[model samples]
Target: MSHPPAPPTSPHPRRWLTSRARVGLVLAVPLLGLVNQFLGFFVLVLAIVLIWKDNPWEKAAKVVATIAATALLGAVVPDPQGKDAGGTVARADGKGTAHGRAVDAVTSASPSPSPTVKPGPRAADYRGLRLDRAREKAEAAGFGVGDHNASDDGKSIWMRSNWTVCFQKTGWTWSDTKTIDFGAVQTGAPCPEEDGGAVPWPKMPDLVWKTWKTARKEVVDLGVPADHVLADTAYVNDTLPDEGDYDDWRVCVTDPSADSDVTLDAWVTLGLTDPRNGCPKSDREDGDRPSLPDRDDDGDPDYHDPFPGDRNRDSAFPNGLPRGSDGSGGSSGDDDWDWNCPHTRWC
Candidate 1:
C-alpha cells in the first residue's frame, strides 16, 4: 500500500503508443486498403479521422506498414485526384475501393475521380429479344457482332427485325467470349427442332371422291386461289343455273393434281363429273382405257389439261397452247398436236 499506485511504471511515448494513439491504430485498418477501393467508405472515414489526429504523416506510415504486413497489399500511392471528389474515391457499390482511400490518405490534395462504370448484360439475357435488338444489346455490352447472326431454321434472315432469338452460344475461350451466337427464327414460325433444318412446305390434298365444293375449299385452304379452281368435268360444269347445285358434283382429276407440293399462287384445276356416274374410266369415256387416249386422236383432250397439247408437261402453259406446236398439226391454235406428242405420264 505504500507503493500506492507508483504511476504504473510509466514508459515514454517511444515505449508505449498508449490510448492517445489508439485512433491512429484504428484508422490504420482502412488506410492499408488493398483490394479495390472496396473499402472506400472506410477509407473516407479514415481520412476524416486524420483531420483530428496528430502527426498525420506518422499515422499514415503506421497504416501503410500495418497493411503491408497483411494480405491486402499492392501498388497504391497517394492520388491528388482524391481531394477533388471531397476526399472520397470509393463508390457505394464498392467501386471507389480501399486502394483509392489509401491513396487519398497518402496525399489527398487533388479531387477524387468519379468514374462512370455501367455494367453490361450477360449472354443469356440476349435470348427472346428481337434479333435486331439482341445484336444492338450485345454491341452495347462491348461485344462486336459482324455477321454472326443466323436463322435456326436455316432460312436466310434478310430482315433481322422480322425474327426473334431462341438460343445462344459463346466463343471457345474467354478472350473471344464476346463472339456470341444467337439462334433465331421468323416471328410467327416455330423454332426448328434442330438448327439448320428446313421448314415444311404446304402440299396439295387428295380431292378424288370429294364434292367439288369441298375440294375447292381444301385447295383454297392450301393457299391456292379461288379463281384458279375450276370444275374438272364439262357436261355438268358449263354454267350452273344456281339451282343446279354445281358444288354438289365430285372431282375426278386435279391439276398439280393430288399430293403435290404447291405454292400459293399456283393455279388449281378440278375435273368435274356427275357424283352418281363417277370419274371417267378413260378418254374414251364409259370406261377408262388405263390410258386416256386423246379424244380427238390428235392431242390431249381440251377438258382439264392446262397445257392441252404439250404432251405430259401439265404445267408448261396456263392457257391452252397451240396444237402440234412442233409444226406437226396441219394448223396452229386449236389444231391437234397428237401427231407428235403422244399419250404419256398420266394414268
Candidate 2:
C-alpha cells in the first residue's frame, strides 16, 4: 500500500516574514548605527522566530540556560588583576573620550550657516497681503516706508531696514529670525563675490537704494528739513564696505545747516544684505556699483555735534545761537574747525 504523501511542509519562519517586512529589514540595516530602537526590535523579532520553531517547552529552558551560562562564564572569567584591571579601569575612567565623541558627532551633523536675505523691491518677498497696505502699516507703526522688490513671482515683498515678508501663498511661510535697529550701524565691508570673480552681487544696489530712501523719507516726514541728500555711487575701497549681511543700515536724521524745526534725533545703524551682495546704490548713475566717497561728508570726524540736539534750534539754544560757535556750539580754538564753522562737511 502506497503510504499517504507526507504532509506538505509548513512555511519556514524566516520565509513567513512578508516581502515588505524583508524589505523593511534590509533598509533598516543601514540605520542600525545611529538608531538603537530599530536594532533591538530586529533582534527581538529574530529571536521570537527561533524560539517558536524549537521544541514546544524548549523555549523556557533555552532562556534559563542562556542566563545561567552567561553568569557562569562571567564568574569563570576571573577577576582581572594588576595590569588587566588597569586597562579595564582606564576605559571606565576615560571621561574625556566620551565628551570628545559627543562633540565630534554634533560638529559633524550640524548644518552650515545660511546667508542673509535683504528687503528690496520684490513684493512677493514681504509679509501682508497687499504691498502698499503693508507699507502703510509699517509707517503707522513708526517705521519708515520705502520701495519694495518682489521675486520673479509676486508672492513676497522685500522692504527697507532688512525687512522681508511673504504674501499668502500655498505651502509658504516665514519666521522673523530677528529685529534690526537702524540707529547703531557700523561701516561694513563690500559685498563679496557670489559665484566667481568680480562685480558684486547684482541685488546689492537695490538694497542700498531702498534703505536710504526709507531713512530719508522718515526724516522728512518726521518734520526735519534736509538741505541736500547725497548718496555714494562709487565702488571705491571703502572703510565701511557693505557686508551684505541682513543687519539694518545706520539711519541718521540730521540737518547740515543746524536749522530745522523737528523734535526727534534718530541715529541707528544695522546690517542689511542678501546672501548674494551688499547695499544697493541710491544714485542709479553708477550703474549698480557702490561709489565710496573719498571723505566722510556725513559730519562724522570733524564736527563733535553733527546734528542739533533737537529738531528745533530754538529749544536747543533758548536764546538766539549761544555765544561760542567753533561749530561744536562750544568755545573756539585754533583748529581749522572755525574755517568750516557752521558748514557741515564729509570726513
lDDT of each: 0.56, 0.35
lDDT tens digits, residue span 1-347, model 2: 89888988886675556533533443343344234544544544554444345434355765754454334334334342332222211222445552212111112233667896555322222342344455555555544444423222122333334432332221212453322112111112121232112322112111222455564555455333453333332233323335332223342222231232232232322232322234444447756434332233432212122343323122223333423444354545443333233433322
Best by TM-score: 1
What is the C-alpha lDDT profile of model 1 across 1-347, one tens digit per residue? 37655556555674245434544544454455544454644554554454435543466765654454232222343344435334534433466445434233434355567896533335557767889999898877776553333433334778899878866765533454456667787664544555555434477888777888788889887666677876645343232225346778877777886778665347878776655555755356555323343433433344544554555344333333343355444445464555333433332
Which ten contiguous residues of candidate 1 have the minimum total lDDT? 69-78
Off by over 4 Å in 2: 1-44, 52-54, 57-60, 64-347
